[model samples]
Target: MHQSFISYKNFKSLKGSVVLCAAVLGLYVVAEPSATSAGGTWLGYVGGCLGGVLMVWLACLGIRKRKYKNTELLAVGWVSTHIYLGTALLLVVSLHSGFHLGLNIHSLAYAFTVMVILTGFYGLYAYSIYPDKITLNRDGMSRDSMFAEITEIDEKSLALSEKISPEMFAKISENVEETKIKTSLLTRLFSDRSLKEGAIYKAIDFVREQHSGSELIKELDSLLQEKESLVGKIERDIRYHFRLGWWLYLHVPLTVGALLSLLIHVYVVLFYW
Candidate 1:
């Protein structure tokens, strides 16, 4: 025989919540009847409030369930409910506002909420895409190995500098110091235009005039090899950084905008309404 058990707490929590939400929505619809409501019709307000409450409740449920057990299941449930209800909220809130947006705090709050939802959608897309990119990159490379590769190139570059003109050697040294050729994604992509390409072109032109076996030619050749490797690493790093960074750019600003709008909305509803 199989024994089965269930948590009364979870059942109680769910049941109490549904009752409370229904009651609140019912009250909003039936109590204190408005003769000429500007915001929305009583039915529209009821529907919107009910939908918002349900969505918020589902999100909270997702959080609470994850804390107990079956995190993956909870996460999936949470994301699904979040996306579906967030989309619903867009419609609900729009109807709740009755499509009348004036220069007021409530309108501002509504606008902010829309902005936050849009950014959040973009963030979801980013989260889904970036992990694949990170996995692809880490398939054969580790962070320490990438650093080691750069160090190897640097050593080669230093050796090559030995046969170059003193001025060229000094310039190379200055460039290296100014740009600490790390495997950082941001530094790799944005800083690539500054030094390596120009240096390689100049070095190639200068070295070609010298005999193949000469010290100047050998130094330049070694420098060219190292530069090519560094460029490749930097390119990959930039791609990785960009893959993750763009979402943050969208999500963070919108969140801040939402909070500001919420504050304005609360102030208007409390004092003006």
Candidate 2:
């Protein structure tokens, strides 16, 4: 129930951002660079240097995860600082550019930085929300446990189906097929909602009409309902698991692109200046 991202870690980072913004503004006010905070000016260089340093440090988060690959830097503080400082980096870089971007590689770097920051925001939002959903959906049953439950349901449903007519056996087979074992991520998440809904309703109607009549139908209906429930649980588990992970697909790639562009930005500014 408690999400760490919104707590003391981010609060400290927010405090740091406030102080940093004040410093950037105070320097700009006092020094008063010509025409703008041009990169050549002392204040301008300060901004660019600060922004560049922040970007490089931000890149360290990736290294920390890969290299450390453990709880060493995996604290809430590291991640929250990374997120908050990343937001601050955008502002610092904008100041560094003196709000003057154009059709140059420098501007391309700016665009990439913006993309990275935007994706970070998305990742933050995703992390804040999705973990809770995944945990709740899991409800203490791990994915392997869910699979095991499904396997047991399969055996029971098949045994029960053998006592029924061919028509009912085919119905059970079709219902089992709806579980959909090998689906792409998007298809697993969104493709079969209506289909599952329709199937649940039809199964409910089947149980109501037939379960009270024939003993065979009654037993088959119980097995059918159990299988349907297991399938629903499995699908939810799949959907939420994907939700927790899919943000990284976009966030990490954009981050690497931003870092590459950032390197180019540094090299060009240093040599060209």
Candidate 3:
């Protein structure tokens, strides 16, 4: 019963995009240019205009999404339209170029368009997959709650380790001090933090070395295991969080670059060419 942005209004944007692409394809097929089918021709001009409009509209989606009041369009509808029309814009641009590519500013604009669209595709995939993954990883507990619980476990483990031995106490303290819940952006996104696991394993080994089957050691072992589980969940949650938004960093900048290059390309074509 839950309708996602992709399925908004019974795939209305998808249908519109398909129709638009089909119509453009028909025109491209029928148009007979004086020479090559390039951006200078009549149909090519149409395609260029459509592609330009679509590019500007797609870029506006970031602004549209940020508006929270008095907007006529639903946010989901805007997103759905953005996804569908953005794809169509690629084909329109390619046809507008008459499949011709060269080491020129026009091609540079097209290249930026390609990069922006590719990043947008990755963003769409991330949005679809990561939200559920983050929810499952958190399991109804906020990240702050998980960290708070880890701190509590560390305190209890420190007390138990102190009663057991000085070496155990020192090891537990070092582990707690070195355990990192936050890391560098690239590290959080690409690498798993395993220091917490090493500390837990070392503590378990130390307890086993003591050769005592005492309840205090048992409780300490349980706490270490619990801490390990929480740290793993937090690391995974951090990865999912970064994965969801990192593409926007590339996508937005490339969009701005593409728009600027497109403006220069249009200016040259209209006034000089």
Which candidate number would show the highest lDDT if scored against the true structure? 3
Off by over 4 Å in 2: 1-3, 67-74, 181-216
Cα RMSD of predicted structure 1: 8.9
- Per-residue CA lDDT of model 1 for 20-64, tens digit only, reads 545544554556646533345565556545544643453354346
How well is each residue in 109-172 modelled by candidate 3, as lDDT tens digits?
9999989988989989989999999999899999999999999999999999999889889988
What TM-score, to 2 decimals, does candidate 2 have? 0.84
Residue 8 error for model 3, in Å?
Answer: 1.3
Using TM-score as the yardstick, the better of models 1 and 3 is 3
lDDT of 3: 0.88
lDDT of each: 0.56, 0.72, 0.88
**What's the C-alpha lDDT at position 113 in model 3?**
97
Best by TM-score: 3
Arranged by lDDT, best first: 3, 2, 1
TM-score of each: 0.59, 0.84, 0.93
Task: Tell me the spans in candidate 1 whose CA falls farther than 4 Å from its real position.
Answer: 1-39, 54-77, 128-139, 142-144, 160-175, 178-196, 204-223, 239-243, 256-272
Candidate 3, poorest ten consecutive residues by summed lDDT? 188-197
